[model samples]
Target chain A: MRELIAIEYAKLKKFHALKIIFAVYMLTVPGWMYFMNFFFQMEPGMKALFTSDNPFDFPHIWSYITYSASFFNVLLAVIIVVVTTNDFQYKTMRQNIIDGMSKQKVILSKFILVFFLSTIATLYTGLVGLVIGLIESTSYDWYQNIHLIVLYFIQTLGYFSFAFLFAIIVKRPAIAIVSFILYFPVETIIGKIMNADAYQVFPLKVFADLTPIPFFKSIVVSMKDQGGKTPWILDTNIQIILSLIYVLLFFLLSYYLLKKKDL
Target chain B: MQQEIVLEVKNLVKNFKKVQAVKSINLNLHKGEVLGLLGPNGSGKTTTLAMLLGILHPTSGSFSWFNNGTKDENRKRIGSLLETPNFYPYLNAYDNLKVVGIIKNVANLQERIDSVLELVDLKERGKRPFRTYSLGMKQRLAVASALLSDPEVLVLDEPTNGLDPQGIAEMRQLIIDIAKEGKTIILASHILAEVQVICSHIVILREGEMVYNGSMNSLLNQEQAFRLSATNMEQLEQALHAISGISITERTETDLLVTCSEKIDGSSINKRLVEQGIYLSELHAYQKNLETIFLEKLTQ
Candidate 1:
């Protein structure tokens, strides 16, 4: 396992596109967070629209960090697609098997890659969160805020595992990335027909609800106050458990696809 | 010498959609023998190798490696280069081989990589990314990876597919050297001459069917035929009747093809024809090589 991870890391380092995508995610996240934070404080219209205490305050700091970094997961997912598709495109996966690694080891190597990437993303988000929170928040509760780090890791894992599945099933990077990017709107359209509680069970929605925007939670609470039924998405633990299941399902399906593949 | 069976494939078949890519091919690879698989395009050579390496699932039947051990354990003892060199294009040959070494769990990683690099004659260019390599260099690197583990058996598919004349000669010699090291080798090629020079045993596949499988000597050492012509047709006819174990397989207006058993000597037949007063002409021996036999089998 350690050897496989080292090999994967070496390959990833040499892959220019993946490195570029990762650099984009790393450089863009903090700048994007800073820009959003600056706008909410400086722009009167933005301030009126947001209508909240300093969004970067102690309790809100976790949500701010995770929410701001959440959309960047799409780019990271694209990186995953590129990395996985490189092996397929070059037929290196088949070579790996020929070189004596079993099919399970091939899939396990990619899973380890996903775990590594997700861990890095989680640590980066944690670092960004700490800096921003110390700067903006008057009080700090490390235990409360650090839970968001775990959720962030799971969310990244969910996204990357889905990308891995897409790359395996699709086998073409461009098509896989386009399809993954399009899945959100398609799922949203499907979500509307299902009851709100049932829609929360969807994979991406489960991940999204993990670090629900701080303002969105306030709106949901007020809606409940106005006699709105509390959607199942309000239960973070259910979403986490369901997300875990989906993560496993995606990985298992990816494994099955690779194990049964001809190449 | 008793040769141990290293690979046993029983009724192996592979079908892709409606096309039967590999018909039931049954073969056993013995230890330290170089086996060549000969066929034209779409003859299921690659498919057969893929199935053995577990890259493709066989549609029917089964194959076992190294005394029928589990695949994981068996694969560790085998090194293969199937169809193409599958490596990261961006990585140098050394790094690509390091990945192979890691996968195969080779000890003294850098030392083995250096030795294999030297073995392939790519020590100088091992630092260049694989994409920069010419086709011959790419091929040599693939061979290098297959040899990385010092595996018991080597499965190579068209290892010389894209080499120049000199490159092909070098590759042939390399294969010969590897075979000398007592490693079982399964080589697939359309180049009949390459197989003839490098392989001790041969399997011929045509349209996904095993038309021929046996020793190379058996494939090439069949009864030979000679084309005979004479100035006196009448005397030639009479003289031909005097030779035993020589049958006329084909005849033209000016020539007759006389087939003889392997036990018959050309000089004896010549002496008999001379004794019968029918020798004032030409005699040409046509020994069958693998190309003729392969073409004949394909047509059949």
Candidate 2:
């Protein structure tokens, strides 16, 4: 497994396009945070929201930045698609098997890349959140709600695992990327049509629920003049568990398909 | 009393939907023997190699390397180049070889990569990306990749596919040198002459079926053909008919190609014709080549 992961790194580390895309992903998350911070600070009327705390306060900022950073998980997901499909596009996965790696290992290598990318992205987002919350917020309490970092990692795995599945199924890089991106809206439309209980277990819904829009819940509560749970919203624990299931299911399906198909 | 078996395939079959690509291919390749896999287009040559390499799953059948079942670990012992040189187009030769090294778990990867690039005569351009390579250079890099692990078995399909004449000669010589080192090589090529020189055994496939399988010497040592023509054509033909074990197989534009069962020299045939009051002008020995035997197998 260590060798397989090393092989994946050797194949991808020098890849300029992949590096550029990854750099963009890492930068865009913090860049978007800074942009959002600027937009929020420019406005004075928004201070009323956190119920009793401002959005940038240390504890609130943890959830706020994590919620904001999770949206960019799609970039890491795209990276997954590109990395996996490049093997197919270049016919290198077949070569890897020919060179002595197992077909299962071929798929496992990409899964390693998926996990590796998600871990780095999560760590980068966490570090950026910590730095920004430290500099922007005036609170000595750094550990408050910091467990969102773990949630960020799981959210990345959710998006990236789905992207890994799409890459294996689609093969062609362009087609895989386009379809992977397009599936969000397609699932959104499908999720809207499903009943409330069924929609709670849907893949995209569960992954999205990992980091709900930070202040949106409070804003909705203020608007409603009453505090109540929506029928479609799943408990974060349930969402995390379901997302882990989807990750396992997607990778297993990918392994099965790769074994069955002729490279 | 028997040499080790490098590879054995039994009733190997592959189907693409309704179409069968390889039909029950059965052959045994012993150690230190160069096996030439010959077939025309779409004869499942590539498909067979693919199955053995584990890139394409066989529908039903089995093949083993070094008498071991198709284990993933055994594949690392065999280096193979299937179809084209599969590499990251964005990576240079050194980096490309590094990927192969990692896959095969080659120790001292940097040194191995350098040695292979040097062997392929691409040392100067080792850092150049694969996309910028010419067809010949790309093919050479593939050969380098296949040899990087110093595998016990080398499976090369069209190793000299896009090389220039000199490059082909060099590549063929490299294969010969490698074969001389007692490595088992399974070569699939359209260049029959090249196979005739390097391979010790041959397998011919026609339309997804094995038409011929045996030693190269056994296949080539079947008959001796001589293009004999004389000044008195009628007397020459009659004399050839009178000689036992000599049958005229075809009449070319200027000579009668007589297939001789026994190994008779050109001088002997000339002397025999002269004894019949026939003056000989042409008595050229036409050696049986792989091309002739391959075509015969295919047509059969």
Candidate 3:
């Protein structure tokens, strides 16, 4: 497994597009966060939700980072698609098998790569959050916000693994990215048409709900002012569990398809 | 001495949707033998190699490598090149081989890569990315990768598919050198002359069936053909028709080709034709080479 990962790492080192996507993600996440913070500070009306407190403070800082990082999952997912589809496009997957790696090893290599990418994204998010929190938080509290890091990791894993599955099912990178983009709208439309809470557990919805946009607090503040009830779904535990299950399902299906499909 | 069997394939078949690409191929490769898989396009040669390498699943039948049924176990001892040269297009030739070395688990990585690069004559261009390479360079890099592990068996499919004449000669020489090292080689090619030059044992596939499989010497040792033509083509035909031991296989405006029993000689045919009052314009005996045999089998 280490050797496989080493080989995968070597392949990625020369893969310029993946490097570009990763660099953009790493740069964009923090840059976007700073810009959003500046905008919120400029607008007094938007600033009333947290009562003039630094949103980058410990407890609230987790939400700030997680919410911003969640959107970049699409970028990370595109990275996954690019790396996975490259092997198929270049016929390197078949060559790997011919060179003596097992089919399981080939697929596992990609899975490991996705996990590695997600882990890196998580660490980068937490590091950025730590820097922002240290500069802004009046009360230093690290342990209180660590669970957000865990949730962020799971969310990234869920998205990247889903991308891996999409690459396997749809071998072309362009089609896979397009399909991945359309997944949410398509699933949401279908879920609303079905109009059953049961169908809310579908893949895209579960991942979206995992580390949700942290605007529920702001919505609740305005709703309280207007005497409206919170329509937010607050079950993080259920979302985490379901997201993990989807991650496992995506991985197993990718493995099955890679092993069963002709290279 | 009995050679150890390195590979044994029995009743191997592959079907793609409605087309049966490879239908029930069976053959054996012994240690240190250069085995050639010969066939034209769509004859299932590539499919057979793919199935044996575990790239394509067999619809039915089974194959064993080094007497081991487990693919992983057997595959670790084999190095294969299937179809086109497949490496990361953006990676240089040296890095591409490094990837293969890691997968195949070769020791002394730098030295092995260098040796293979030298062998394929791509040492100077090893730093160039695969996408920048010409077709021959790509093929040379593939050969370098295949030899990276110094594996016990080498399975190559059309290793010379897109090379110029000189590149083909170099690639053929490389295979011959590897074979001389006593590695078991299974080569698939549509070039009959190339196979004749490099292979000791041959399996000929026609329309997914193994029409011929045996020693190269045995397949090439066909009955010698005698060509004869006379002033009177009609008399020549009548005289050859009256002959019991000989059968005329081909006849054109100029000559009649006859295959006779071992007891007959070219002089006897000539003497008989003379006695029958048919003056001969030409007469010669010739043995069939691999090309003639291949053409015969393909037509059959």
Q: Candidate 3 regions off by >4 Å?
A: A49-52, A215-234, B229-234, B249-256, B261-283
lDDT tens string, model 1, A153-204? Answer: 9999998898899999999989999999899888888998887867878888
Q: What fraction of correct interface contacts does each candidate retain?
A: 0.74, 0.94, 0.78
- Tell me candidate 1's interface RMSD: 1.3
Instruction: Tell me the tens digit of each residue's lDDT in model 2 across B3-23.
Output: 899898999999998789999
lDDT of 2: 0.86
On residues A204-238, what C-alpha lDDT tens digit does candidate 2 reach at each position? 88888887777656666666666555434677788
DockQ versus reference, model 2: 0.82
Stronger candidate by lDDT (2 vs 3): 2
Candidate 3 lDDT over residue span B94-177, tens digit each: 889889889888899999999999988889987888899988889888888888889999999989978999988888888888
Error of 1 at B173 (Å): 1.0
**Candidates 2 and 3, the one with greater DockQ:** 2
Point to the candidate with the largest TM-score: 3
Candidate-wise lDDT, in order:
0.85, 0.86, 0.85
What CA RMSD would candidate 1 show?
A: 2.7
Q: Worst ten-residue run, lDDT, model 1 chain B?
A: B67-76
Q: RMSD, each candidate, Å?
A: 2.7, 2.8, 2.4
